[model samples]
Target: MKKVINNPENVVNEMVEGFIAAFGNDYKKVHHTNGVVIKNKPNRVAVVTGGGSGHEPLFIGMVGEGLADGAAIGNVFAAPTPNTVLEVTKELDSGQGVLYVYGNYSGDVLNFDMAAELAELEDITTKTVLVNDDVASATKEHAFDRRGIAGDIFAIKIAGAAANDNLTLEEVARITQKAANHTRSIGVALSPSSIPSTGKYTFEIADDEIELGMGIHGEPGVKRTKLQTADELTANMLDYIFDDIELQENDEVCVLVNGLGSTTLMELFIVNRKVVEILNEKGISIYDTDVNSYCTTLEMAGVSITLMKLDDELKNYYDKPAYSPYYFKKGRG
Candidate 1:
């Protein structure tokens, strides 16, 4: 329960305020809501994303120049309200349509779909692409039933870039959908993240054990076993990803080695090192590799590896300049 704050109930609000204070020049709040939008939106199709708040640099950090146009923020590990999502849509919707991108969580799906319906009443044409990239969540036959994790960044980046190119909403949505379909991710948790409001860890694991393929909120993983070395663990996680995606030799990919909060860069790089070695051995070319804490559960000690199988079409958009307080993978010069 050791955290710096005024009140537990006010953590989301306070965090939002602090984020604004630090990044107000590029973003602004939707009227009376947790929805955050770029201060000056473009005339192209808008890409909006959202989810629970604890995963900082996620729903919020994804907004910027070549990223999401707006982000509807929910409470910690909670989905954004329909009203909050609608507000963000209202702000981002130009003459062009809007595309909604978010993780494939039940609460998030419910709220975002409601928001889309509400937006439709306002004559804002909208499309949705759910990021269901967590390979360990479901079998390959049930890929669409899986959860979204670090793979969300791939969808956001491709979609945001296509939108910035002033492509039609349909085209942008298509590109985003392609990215979501091509992405696969898997994670292992060494420790659980603490809930800010309750000051309790969301889940528990023995100190000598790790949960393979655990979801960010500590949803049950595929297995729990004694902790292994970084190389072994990385390969174990990748086994699931490779099984999910039929990666072939000479295929190109964008790899994301994401850290869930407390994991250090040093450890993350070690994991990434193993990832590179594996991909190289498989003869799969890497378009780019980003090893960072782009998505996280608060101070959760674990890392998730995401692979976005790329086609030339997807790569064109992915390489576009994007920027926010976080995520400089394809940032502007």
Candidate 2:
């Protein structure tokens, strides 16, 4: 509870109000809900994404050019209410359609599905592509059941780019699903994040310990071990990713080195160095490497590596320029 805030109950509301006030020129608050939509009128299929709060620069900050059109937000580690999602869908749907891209969490799955059904009743075409990229959460036999972690942005980026190209909702969803399937991620948590509402740490680990395959929502990972070197930790993570996706020589990919809150950029770069070296040794072509704290868990000391296996079709959308305050890319379009 060492956070700089007034009341825990008002965290979500106050944070969102502050976000709208700061980014109002390009984004607007969705009426009567903790949601925000881009002010730009839609000329393409709308892309909407959201999940529990606490993962900053994610569902909310991700709404902008080349990203989501709107995002319905929920409280810390909670799902957005069905009504909140519905309002965002209503605002962004410009007769083209709407696509929902979000992490594959049970809460998100339940709420977004309900909202999609509600949208359909009103004749607003809607589709969903659940992001299931956390390789440690499930085995290949249960791949679809894996939890979505830092890899959500890959699916969001691809979905937004396809929608920006004026692809129909169905096409955009198809491409996004492909991206979600091709992407794989694994994380090592050196520590745990705290809950704003409860003012308690989600979980705890010893000072010299790390949890492999930790979920963003603080679910205990597949296994825990004493902390290891940067190279060893990253190599261990990459092994899980490679086993899941089976990357091969000459295969291209987008690498996202995501920080889970308290992990520093310096540390991330060290991890990225090892990642690049391994990729080179394996003959995997790195299409683009983004090392940043894009997806976070509120000062949790951890990092997750995401690799999106790409083909020509996926490359086309992925190479499109994306502009958001948090995630900006100057693609060679």
lDDT by residue for model 2 (39-88), tens: 97568899999999999989897888888999999998899999999999
Write down the TM-score of every candidate: 0.98, 0.98
Worst 10 residues of 2 by lDDT: 324-333
Clash pairs of candidate 1? none
Q: Tens digits of per-residue lDDT for model 1 on 1-333?
A: 478878889999988898899999888988899999998897889999999998988989999988999999899999999999998998888879999999999999999999989999999999999999998898888887999999999999999999999999999998999999999999889998888788899898998999999999999999999999999999998998888789999999999999999899999999999999999999999989898898899989999999999998998888888888797764432
Assess the local accuracy of residue 53 in candidate 1 as a C-alpha lDDT between 0 and 100: 93
Weakest 10 consecutive residues, lDDT, candidate 1?
Answer: 324-333
lDDT of 2 at 194: 82
Please identify model 1 stretches exceeding 4 Å from their true place.
330-333
| Deviating ranges (above 4 Å) for candidate 2 | none
Candidate 2 clash pair list? none
